[model samples]
Target chain A: MHPADEVLVARYVEEADQAAFRTLVDRHQERVFGYLRGMVKDRDVANDLFQETFFRVIRALNKERGSYTRQGKFLGWVLRIARNAALDHLRARKKWQDLGNGDDGDESAWWDRLPDDGPSALESVQDMEEADLLKACIDRLPPEQREVVLLRHESDLTFREIADMTDCSINTALGRMRYALINLRRMMEEAKRLEHIPASD
Target chain B: MHNGKKDILLHLYGEATDAEELRSLLRDEELRREHAALSEAKFRLDHLKRERPDPVIMDRILAAAAGEQGLPSSTDRKDRPAVARSARMRKVMLPALTIAAAILFGVAVGWFSSQPGTAQVDEPAVATAPDDIVPPESLYRFVPPQPVTPASTQDPRLAWDDSAPLMDMHRRIESMRPEGMLDWGEQAVPLESLPGSGSRSLQLTGSNKN
Candidate 1:
C-alpha cells in the first residue's frame, strides 16, 4: 500500500525529500485549486493563490519541521493554509480598492473589496457556461458556508477539524455544511426550471 | 432518528453510522422525508464540476516548493549568487528609494501649494474637448443670482412629487400577473431576463416576490 499523507509529510520534512513534497502537491493541488477557483472565480488569480498556498506550507515546514505535528489530517492543514491565503488576498485587494482606484480595470477591484457576507460577487461567474453552474452554486453560498462545504467534501476534513479551523463549534460547522447543501439544491432547481423554458430565438 | 436538523444532516452525510440509528431512521416518516431532501441536495451538490489548475502552474509550484526544500537544481545554484546580489541591492536600495520618494513628494507638495495657479487640487479639471483642455479663467465659477422664495411659499404637494414614479411602479407591480410557479422552493426568480420583457419593471417586481 502507498504511504499515508502524514508519512509523506514526515519524509519531506525530516529528509527534505523534494519528491515527497511534490507528491503531496500533486495529491492535493486539484482540490486546492478547485476551492480557490470557486472562491475567486478567476483562473489566473486561482493559479497565483495555489502557488502561494504551497509556498506558505513549505515555509512553515522549514521553520518547524523538527516539531512538526500532524493536526487532524494533512489535507486539512494544507487547506487551512490555502483558505487563509485566499482570504488574505481578498482582504488586501479590498483594502487596495477602498483607496479609490477608479480606472476601468479597477472595476473588479471594487467588487472584490465589498463585504462577502453573501455570494454577491459570483454573479459574473453565473453567466459563464453551464459547466460553471456548479461553481456558481458554490459561489452563491455565504463564504463561511462555502468554506465548511469545501473543507468537509474537498479536503475530507472532519467536522471537528473544520470547527477548529473556522473557530466555530462543530455543530456550527455542520450547520453551515447543511445549509450549503440546501442552498445548492435550490440553485440547481432554479437552473433546471430556466433550462426548460424554450429560447425566443 | 428524527432528532433535529443537525442529526438529519449528519445522518444524510453518513457521519451518523450507528446501526441502531440507521434502523430507527428508516422507520421514522419525518426523518425519511428529511433524508430524501438531504439526499436530493447531496445529488445536486455532486453534479458540480471540479476545477483543475493548468499543468504549467503545477510545475511552477513544484519547482518553487523544491527550491524551498533546499533541493535547488544546478541552474538554481548557478543563479543563487546573482539572485542573492539582486536581493541585497533591493534591501539596501529600497530604503534609500523610499527616502528619495518622500523628499520628492514633499518638494512637489510644497511647490504646488506655493504656486497660485496650481492650488486647487481637489477640483478635477473639466476639459470641454479631448484635444484642447482650456484652463479655467478663475478658481471659482460665477453663480447666477436667484430670487429667494420662503420655505412656506412653495407648494407642499410638489415636495412629494418624487414618489410619483415609485407609486406608478407599485401600481404596475400590483397589476402584474405572476407568470410561473410560486414558492421557488429555493430557486430564485431569474431577474436577468426581465429587462427584455414587455413589462420589465412589473415582471421584476412580481418575480422577485416569488
Candidate 2:
C-alpha cells in the first residue's frame, strides 16, 4: 500500500524490522493473494504460492547480505514471482491443464467498471452479473488466450511484462493480446441474451 | 460496412507504422460499433480480479520453503551447481579470466626457463597457485637449486664431452712425441687437463691430434 514499496522493503532488509515487513504484507497481501488465487484456482495451491512468494523475498533478502533493489517497479516483479510459482507447481504435478475456478469463487467483475452509486442502493447487482458473465467468457476462451487476457487485463500488467512473467516474448505477448481482444468480441456475440439481469443470490 | 482494414485496430493499440490510416478506418460507423463492442467484452473479462486465497495453504508453502516441509534445513548453498552464477559472471569474468590465465601460463614458462639450471631439474612442473595471482617474491624460493656435485669418477657422458677429445689428442701427441719426450712414459699429457685449459688449448690439441 506504500506509494513506493521500495523504501520500506529496503529498510526491512537492512534492519530486521518485523513491523515494516508487516506493513508491506498488510498493504499488498490482498492483491497478491487475489492474484495467486486467480492463477492456480485451488485455494490451497494459491495460498501455498502466496506464502512462497514472501518466503522467497525473505530468503533473497537474508542471503544477499541485507541489500535490496526496489527496482522502481515492484508489482511486476512480485507478480512474476507468483506466476513462476504457479507454473512450477503445475509442472511438478505433471498436470498441464486449464486453470479452474478458485476457492471463495472469482469476483473479477470489479476490475473494469463504470462506477455506480444509487441514492438507496444496498448493493450494485450489475457488478455481480458482470463478474459471472466474465467468468463464463474467460472459461470459454482457449487456454493460451485465456491466460493472456487474465494476466494483461485482470492482472493489470502490460503485455511485455506479461510475456516476461509468463516466459514468452514481447511479440508473442502482443499477438496474444490481439487475439484475446478479437476472441472476446466473438464470445460476446455468441452469448444468449437474457431479458432481465438477475440480482445477486 | 466492415472496413477491409479492421485488422488495423491492433496496430492502433500497438506501435504500427500506419497508425493514422487505422484511425481513419475506425471512423466508419459499423467498424466503430464493432470496436466498442470488443472493448466492452474485454473490459468485462479484465475486471474479474477479486479472488481470495485460502489461508491454510499459504502456511504450508512458507513451511516447505523454510524446510519445515517435514525436513530440516540444508542451509549450505553448496549443492546447487555454479551454473547460474557462472552464467551471470560470463559477461565480465570469462574474458578477463582467460586473458589472466594466458598471461600466467606465459609467465610460468618464462620463469621456469630463466631460473637457471632447470635442465638439471627432473621433477615435472606443478601449478602452485591460482592462475590469476602474481607469484610473490617467495614463490621461486621453493624451487631450490639442485646441488651440483662434482663427480669424482666423472659421468662417461660428461667425460665424453669433457675428457674424451683430450684423451684422443693426448694419444696422438704421444704417438707424435717419439717417446720419452715427456712424463707418463710416452710424453702424453693427462686426458682431463688439456681441454680444461680452455678453448684455445683445445683447438691446438685438436690440431695436433693428427
Candidate 3:
C-alpha cells in the first residue's frame, strides 16, 4: 500500500528526502492541477499555479525545519494553496490584462479566446464530441454552481468541506449542487436537441 | 415520504451510511427514475477528463525540493507571534535598554561630580549637599554592575537554542518577499469565474500544452 499523504509529507519535511517529496507531488499534483485548470480555465496558467502550489508547500514544509507534523490533511493544505494561486490569477486577470503586453484591454475576452483543446482518452469520435459539449456546458455554468460542482466532483471534498471552502453553509453547498445538476441536465438535453436538428445542406 | 434532496445526494455520493436503505429507496420506480437522472449527471461530472501535468513542472518541483532542503523550514509560519515578539523586543527594547543604561550612567557621573569630594576641583568654598541628603549607603547601592564580555560568563537572558532566533530572523525577512518583488498587482480573475472552473480531470489528459 502507498504511504499516507501525512507520512510522505513528514518524510520530505523532516529528512528533506527528495524521493518522498516526489511521491507526494505525484499523488496530488493531478488533483491540484486539475482544480487550478478548472478555476483558471486555461492550461498554461494552471501549470504555473501548479508549480507555485508545490513551491509554497515545499517552503511551508521546509520552514518547519525537521520538526514537521501534520496539522490537517496534506491534500487539503495543498488544495488551499492552489485555490489561492488561482484566485490571485483570477483577481489579477482583469486589470493586468495580457501578461507581458498590456494592450488586450478586453477583460472578458481573455478566457473566451482560449482554444478548446478537445476531448481526452475516449475511443469514439461521438463520445469525444459529447464529452466536449458537456465540458463546454460546465464551463458556461454560473460561477457559484460551477464551483460547487467542481469542488464536489473534482476536489473529492465533502459538502461540509466545500461549504467551508466556499464560506457558505452545508445546505447552501448542497443546494448549489442540486441547482448545478438541474442546469447540466438542461444543457445536455439542449445539446442533444441541437445534434438531432437536420444539417442545412 | 418524499426523500429529501440532501439525503438523496448524500446517499448517491456514498456519504450516507445506510446503503441498504438507499438501495431499497432506489427500488421504487419514481425514486429510481429521479436517482438515475442524478447518477447520469454525476457520471458526466466525473467523466470530465483530467489533463496530465507537464513533466517540466514535475522536474521543477523536484529541483525546488532539492534546493529547499538546505534552506530553513517554514515551520515558523505558525509561530509568527512568538517570532514577532522576540524580533519586536530585540528591535525596540534592546535600544531602549541601552539608552536607559546611558542615561543612568550620565546621572551617576553628574551626581558624583556634585559630591564634596569632587567639588574641590571646581571651587573649595562651594557648599556641598548635606550628608543626610546624599546618603553614602544609597550611593553604593546605585553603582552599576561590571560588564562581562566572554560568552561563557555572560548570563543567558533567553535560554533557547542559539540557532533558533537567528533562523526565526531569517524566516521573518524571507516572509517580506511576498509583498516586495513578488507582488504582481491588479491582474485577477473575472467575477463570473469566481464560482468554479470546468473540472479537475483535465489536468491528467496530456502535457502542459494549452
Candidate 4:
C-alpha cells in the first residue's frame, strides 16, 4: 500500500522534492545501514558508508535520472552502492583479508568494542545478547558468504539479484547463503551448549 | 534433479523452487534437518537488530540534497561559518548587483543615443548617400526639357498660325531655319539658286550682322 519507489523517484528527480528523497532514504536507511555494518563490522564506519552511499545515490539520481529504470528495484540499486562503498573502504584499510574466516588475529575485537546500550529489561537484554551473538557469528563468515547473507536477509534481495550484484551465478549465491546459514546455526548451537556447561570452582 | 543443496536453499529463501521438489527434499530426514537449521538461522538473521544510521547522517544527506537542488540548507551552517557567510552575501548582493547592472545598461543605451549622428527610434529612417564622395559631372549634365509656354505668354510671331496658307507657313518655317537651307524631301538643299534666295540671303545676312 506504500507509494511506489518510481513515483517517489520521479517526484524527487523532476521536482527536486527533498521530502520525497527523504522518504526514500528513510525507507531503505536501516537495510542499507545494517548491510554496511555487517560488511564492515563497525558502527561508525557503517555510518560513514551509509552517508556516502546516499550521497552517491542523490548525485546519481540528479546526474543520470534516466539510469534508474523505475522497476521497483531501488532498494537493490542502493544496496549495490552500499556494498561497493563498504568494499572500497575495506580495501583501502587493507581489511579485506580480515573479513575472511579466521584470518585476522583480532577478528572479534570490533564486536567486543560495540556499544552496549540496549534496554534494561531482562527479556530485552537476552534478546539483545542473542542478536549480538548472531552478529558476531555473521562477522566470522567469509566475505562472500557474509555478503550473500546480508544482501538476502537485510536487503531482501533474491538470489538472482544477489548473484547479479556480486558477479556470481544464482546457484553460487544460494550456495554461499546455504553455507552461511549452516555456519551461523552451528555457531549459535555451540554457544548455547557452552552456556549450559557448569564451571568448576 | 532439484533436490540439491542449492535447491534446498532456494526453496528455504522462498525463491522459485518447485513446490513438489521442496516437498520431496523435505521427505529426506537429513535434508529436512538441514532445512530446519537453515530456517532457524534465517529467522535469527531476520530478527537481527536493524541498525539505523545516526540521524545526524540523514540530516547531512538531506542537506546535500538541498545543496544539489540549489536550495538553502540550514543544516551544518554553524559548522561552516565561511560558507554560511558567503551564502548570506550572495543572497543580499545578487539582486543589488542585478539592479546595478540594469541601470548601467540603461545609462549606456541613453548615452549612445544622445551622441551626435545617432538615429532616434521615433524618427523615420531616410536613405542618404555619404557626403564625402563627389559624383561624376555627367550625372549633373542632364538637363530636363523646358516646359512649353502657353500661347498667351508666347511672342505672336512665334505662335502657331492655324489659318495661314500652307505654302506661306512652309516658307516661313524655311526662313526660320538656322542657315539658309531648304527641306527637299529627305535632303536639305542650299537656297542659293532659288529666285528670291539671293536677295533673301543678303537680307538675312544683313539682319544676322545687325
Candidate 5:
C-alpha cells in the first residue's frame, strides 16, 4: 500500500478525516476520471461515477472497515465499485433521465476536454500520436475485451481477479486480454503512418 | 496466452507479481526483439502501460481510506446527536424487519394449507414448502418408488463352463491318428473301457442325450 493511501485509509478509519479523504480524492481524481472516462467513453458521466465511488468508499469505511474482509486487495475493491458505478450510470442514461437534478454539462457543454492550445501537450509528446491511435484501436475492441483491457490498464487489477470480477474463467480472461492485444497491434500496424507521427511533435 | 490482448499482457508481465519472472526472461535481446516485432504488439503496449502507477492516485486512495478528509466516521461519537438518532432508527428498523419476515411466513403458510390437490393439503403437507417459508408440518413428499429386480440364485450355464476339460480331451482324441494312437497311452485303457462299458457310455451321453 502506498504511504499516502495508508494514512488516508487509516484516518478514514479513525477520525472520519475529511482532509485525508480529500487527499485520496486529489491523488486518484485524474486516474479515476480517466478510467471511467475511457470505459463509458464519456467524460461528464465518468466524472459523476468517480465521485460516487469515492463517496461510497466513504460510506463503507464509515459503516466499518473491520466489516470489510482483509482480502488483501483494496485497489480491486475500489475499481469494482467504480465499474459498478459506471455501469449503473450507463443504465440510468439508457433509462432516459431528465436533467432536472441540475448539472448542465450534459451533451451540450463540452466538445472535447483536449484543450484549445493548438494540439496540447499530448500532441507534443513523441508517442502521443501512437497513444491516440492505440487508444482508438483499443476502443474498437469487443466490449468485453475492451472493458477487461481498460480495467487492466486504467485500474491496477490482477488477471485472476479480473477474471473473478468479470465472472469469467481465468483462461477466458487471459484469452480476451490476448485478443485485445492482437487486435490493438493489428490496428496500430495498420495506422503505422498515423502512429509514427508522434502527435506531430 | 492471448486474444489480441497485447496491452494487458504487457502490463501484467511487467507489473503483476506472476509476470515478474516472465519480465526478467525478456532481458534476452532475441526475446525482446521477437516480442516487439512479430510475437505481438499488445505486449508492447502493456509494457508501456506498466510504468509506475501514478503516485497521486495511491496517495488519494490512502487519504480517502483513512478518513483524512470530510468522509464519515465509522464510530458514531457518543456526543453526537446524529449517532443517537441513527441508533434510534436501528432500534426501530430491526423489529420492523423481523415483523415483516414473520408476516411473510404467515402468508406462506396460508398459501400452502389451502392447496387443491389429491393429497391432503394439511399443515404437515405445507411443511414441504421451501425453508424460506415457515417450517412445514408434513415431511412427506411424493417420493417415487425405486424399481427392484430379483437376484438369480445361480447361472443356468454351469454345464457349459464345466465342459472345458472334456472339450480339451475330445480335441486331443479327435486329432489322434492310428500312428499317434499310443500318444494317449495313459488314457488309452480308460478310453477303451468307456466304449466297452454301457454305464460309462450312458453317463458320457448324458441322461437327456437320447
Candidate 6:
C-alpha cells in the first residue's frame, strides 16, 4: 500500500521534498482538473485554474507548514481550494466582459480543441462520444447541482464533506445530488429521444 | 426502516446506512425504481472524461515549490514581459530609494544643526553664577529667578556654585526646628549624662545593680 496523503503532505512540508509534492499533485491532479473542467466548462480555463489551485496549495503548505492538521482530508481541502479558484475565475469573467472573451461563449469549443491523438479505436471513440454527451448534459446543470455532482464524483467526498466544503447543510448537498441525478437522467432520455428522430426528406 | 430519498442516496453512495434500511429501500418498488435510475445516472457520470493539465503547468508548480520561481500566475506566459519589467523596476528602485532616504536623512541632520537654538551636546557645558545672589533668609520669599543664557554661549571657565542654594535651604530648615529640642551635635552623648543616669551607666557597663 502507498503512503497516506497525510504522510506525503508531511514529507513535502517538513522536508521540502519535490518528489513528495509531485506525488501529491499526480495523485490528485486528474480529480482536480476534472472537477475544474466540470465547474468552468472550459478546458483552457480549467487548465489555468488547475495550475492556480496547485500553486495556492504549494504556497499555503510552505507558509503554513503547521496549519495542515486535517489528517485524512487532504483531497477535500485541495478540492475546496480548487472550487474557490474556479468560482473566482467565473466571478471575474462575469464582472469583466473582456476577461474570458470568446472562451466562455461556446461550451463545445473545448471539444474542437481536444487533442488529435484521442480515441483511435471505434469502441473508444463511441465511449468518448458518450462522455462528451454526458459532459454537455452536466454542463447544462445548474451551478449548484453541477458542483455537487462534480465534487461527489471527482473528489469522492461524502455528502457531509461536500456540504462543509460548499458551506451548506448535508441535506442540501444530498438534495442537490438527487436533483442532479434526476436532471441528468432526464437530459439523457431527451438526448436519446432526439437521436432517434428521423431526418426530414 | 422507512426510507427517505436521502436514506436512499446514503444507501446508494455507500455512505453508512442501516442494512435494514437498505433492504427496506430495495423492497419498496417506487424507491427501488428511483434508486435504479439514479444509479444509472451515476454510472453515466462516472464515464465522464478526466483530463490532465499540460505538463508545463506542473513543471511551473513544482518549480514554485522548489523556490526556483515565484508563485505561478494564471497568465504566466502572456504576462511574462510585464512581470520582468516589474522585476527590473524593483531591482533599480530599491537601492535608489535607500540612497534617496539616506540623503534626506543627512540633509535633515544638517538643517537641524544649523538652526539657532538647537542643543550642541558635544560642546562643553558653560557654568555661570547667577547675576544676583540671594541671602539665605530671602529663599523663602520666592525670588523670581533670572533668565540664564544658553549653555553654548556662557563662559565655560566659570564654574556654577550649585551648593549655594542647597546650603541656604538646609539653614532655612534648621531654623524651622523647635527651639528646646536636644541638638545631637557632631559628638556622641555620654552615658553619665543620660536621663536615668545610674541605670543607664549600669546598662552600658553590663553590671547588675540591685
> Which one wins on DockQ?
4
Clashes of each: 0, 6, 33, 0, 53, 0
TM-score of 4: 0.56
Model 4 residue runs over 4 Å out of place are A64-72, A97-128, A199-201, B1-3, B68-210
Q: TM-score each candidate.
A: 0.55, 0.46, 0.55, 0.56, 0.44, 0.57
- Model 3's DockQ? 0.24
DockQ for each candidate? Answer: 0.26, 0.19, 0.24, 0.36, 0.12, 0.36
Question: Model 1: per-residue lDDT, tens digit, A1-201?
Answer: 877898888888789788888888888876788777766667899898887777667767777332236753778777877887788777766621212111122222322333355454334443556546766666656566677777766666677777787776667676667667766776666776666666657
Determine the TM-score of chain B of model 6. 0.33
Write down the lDDT of every candidate, Cα atoms only. 0.67, 0.57, 0.69, 0.74, 0.58, 0.74
User: Can you rank all candidates by lDDT, best first?
Assistant: 6, 4, 3, 1, 5, 2
- lDDT (C-alpha) at residue B126 in model 2: 39
Which of the two candidates, 1 or 6, achieves a greater lDDT against the reference?
6
Candidate scoring better on DockQ of 1 and 4: 4
List, residue by residue over A1-201, the lDDT tens digit for candidate 2. Answer: 354577766666677665566566666666677666655556677777787776666665556323235676566766666766777776676534543322222223322321222221113323435555555555445455656676765566665566676666655555555555666565455443331445448
DockQ of the two-chain complex in candidate 1: 0.26
Chain B TM-scores across candidates: 0.30, 0.26, 0.28, 0.31, 0.22, 0.33
- Worst window of 10 by summed lDDT in candidate 6 chain A: A95-104
Looking at model 5, give its docking quality level.
Answer: incorrect
When sorted by TM-score, best at the front, the candidate numbers are 6, 4, 1, 3, 2, 5
Q: Which ten residues in a row have the lowest lDDT in candidate 2 chain A?
A: A113-122
Decoy 5 TM-score against native: 0.44
lDDT of 6 by residue, A1-201 (tens): 888899889899889888998899999988898899888888888888888888778867877434456578899888878988888787765621211212122322333332233232222222346777787777777667778898889877888888788776677678778878987888777777666666557
lDDT tens readout by residue for model 2, B109-161? 98897775883453233344346465797676778789887652343344345
- Output the TM-score of candidate 1: 0.55
In candidate 4, residue B199 scores what lDDT?
57
Docking class of 2: incorrect
